[model samples]
Target chain A: MPRPAKKPRKSYHHGDLRNALLTAAREVLEERGPSFLGLREISRRVGVSAPSAYHHFPSRDAIALGLAEQGAAELATCLAAAPANPSGSLLTYGEAYIAFVRANPALYRLMFGEGFPAVSQHSAAIRALRERSYDIMKAGLEQRLPASELPIAGLFLWALVHGLGLLLVDRQIVRDGDLEDIIRRVLTLAGTGLLHGRGRDDGQSGPPPPPPGTRSA
Target chain B: MPRPAKKPRKSYHHGDLRNALLTAAREVLEERGPSFLGLREISRRVGVSAPSAYHHFPSRDAIALGLAEQGAAELATCLAAAPANPSGSLLTYGEAYIAFVRANPALYRLMFGEGFPAVSQHSAAIRALRERSYDIMKAGLEQRLPASELPIAGLFLWALVHGLGLLLVDRQIVRDGDLEDIIRRVLTLAGTGLLHGRGRDDGQSGPPPPPPGTRSA
Candidate 1:
């Protein structure tokens, strides 16, 4: 049979321990990378005996995944609550993404790490949450661009925001640099098509183009 | 006065301790975040006595800075070597950013981390490297956009590549997604107009009303 539940072995009070472990894991992550972090390290910080800590987390990976799940849910919430209009979403998405990364660096790293939750199967809630952010972009792309250009526009917008988020979080790009200004300007540029006076492109006017690389990695 | 230089207490062959520290620091970075990393930990891993490391690196921050410098230099090289064409630079820049992050994530983190090399005050070399990438987009923008619009174009292109890099490195977006196609399509959309082909925006036609937060962010 699959391993029995680890929590509530001695008593039903697993909630406190769960939060404590997550707190400790965040500490470890701040101090170091996710790889060097061990459950025992967390247990030590939590003031609990090592094996006893297992009551909350069956294994180290489980704890990490738990954190990642929480992050994805949170990120989804962040993007979901963005301003109502696509234009507004365009302006605030970068700010929200950057703020999320700054507030929860470790959790953010976990959410987007090598073990990033897979889209094909693994978790339905996460996939939906992640896709919702994409949906915002999709709506924008659908409304703003042609159907044929969906794939590239989607990825492009995603990449621009994603990279800027990382830069903001890691402090490579400083907050004092006026990021909001930078992001809005970029979006406007992306949205405008170099030719602004003549607006409303329906795709037939420009040259036909193929999709991006087959293998992105 | 600044602390006196530590003696070259070890072998006089001038065998580089700097590079050794970098490798060890890389290991530490992969294992943790910035604040908690220590020279002691790295020196221990390098099999060098802790104090000896001070001869080369005055402190762990110095080590972190070195890593950041190295990463930026490498990134500059990659961008510099890329062909001048917007499409080529787009593809090359995308691959370069992803490759740097994937191959040396620790260094990549250091490259953008807090208290490290501040990007806004970039060294002349780093500044030019950044500007060169921006220039590619500027050139594209110049064809149809006003010089005033270059800054916005720069940020957009940078954002797209930066976001793609992080997503690919973190595996949040997709390791093998269609990145090249994404770049071209993104460029095409931004270059010609919105992907929607809804308007002609070439700056020369007229400076129609600029979008409100366009310059602010």
Candidate 2:
């Protein structure tokens, strides 16, 4: 693909410089991961001078924090927009959450403080946005679970989606089948519990009998 | 704490050189992260020449792969060592798995190809060790679940522990409470399912009745 001609510096209004720098930083983040999110490179990509980029971002970490904030806000929006069926809302939220991470792998990592260690520590806005996302999950659970169970229940759902999303984005798990189907199945397990024969002898009475076709009559 | 004096170069026999380099590399991985796992720095820490380090590990990536293999083996051992109880073995495994990651956060990240993207792609040995660990979990599940459900069931357990560990290590979740208690509760929820009044109206009726002491009625 041809490199689009760099936008001339004059084309970026003063108010637009920060967004342009963030946009370029995101590209670098996805392409090279967080370690390569250098200010000079981002500025070069934006066709802006270093000092001009500095005026908006100050440092690479600041640019990363900017990206993180943007990611957090977008993620909150995704979670909020998930269909709110009382019984299946978590599945919808989990799907939306993973979908967002799948679409913006690097940005999701950045939001979680992957490369910039201080982003989480320094950004109250990010923390609030993160809390908002968590609240969405907790609110769904609150309808059914006791208040005392909320923390662990919320954490369970969070960890399930969080781990599943990372495993998918990181390609740590097998990808031979449909990714969305895999996600739904996994979340369903979380919702319904994985153990079979729930009330029958602690569900550990050994594997169920093999299907009729597989065994000699 | 004072820095330890560097060992003399002559002290390292050829056979010991590889181990010494790996030890220093592990330290670097923990103190910094994978991005800082440079061969030169590791050699300097080990008081060996860069060429000597190169002789053992052909490149920085080779060193990372070495670390990843080491981490994978250690994790598999940890998982294998988890006690096998038909009913509670997964909780034990999950505890052991999270314990390993908590103890060696950086190595765990490297094992998952955090900084060394090619480590997972290039190291068949690492992949095998990883598979060995997963097999341990699947073995536990196989006793109860049918063969057809193994894939999703196994992935669900993996994602739960994987996500819980990363959240703990990343400090993405609140840390005021006992982490072990939190992990136990979350895994127990996985074991028992989170919904209240299961098998009754889909468990989504509403919040349970207020505790006896809390209600004024």
Query: Number of the top candidate by TM-score?
Result: 2
lDDT of 2 at B215: 11
Sort candidate 2 into its docking category. acceptable
Residue-level lDDT tens digits of model 2 in A1-217:
2223355534345457776777788888888876667888988897877778767666777888888888888888778877777667666777778888887776776666445765746489988898889888777766555444567778888999998988887787875998767887777667675222134223434444332222111
Interface RMSD of 2: 10.1
Candidate 1 stretches greater than 4 Å from native: A1-15, A23-51, A59-62, A83-106, A113-129, A143-146, A172-181, A193-217, B1-14, B20-51, B59-61, B86-106, B113-145, B173-179, B193-217
Mark the regions of model 2 whose C-alpha exceeds 4 Å error after superposition.
Answer: A1-5, A10-15, A120-122, A194-217, B1-5, B11-15, B120-122, B194-217
Best model number under DockQ: 2
**Candidate 2 lDDT tens digits, B88-152:** 87788889999999999878767764456567464788778988999999898787777777787
Go through the candidates in order and give each one's C-alpha lDDT: 0.57, 0.73
TM-score, one value per model: 0.62, 0.83
Error of 1 at B42 (Å): 7.1
DockQ per candidate: 0.25, 0.26
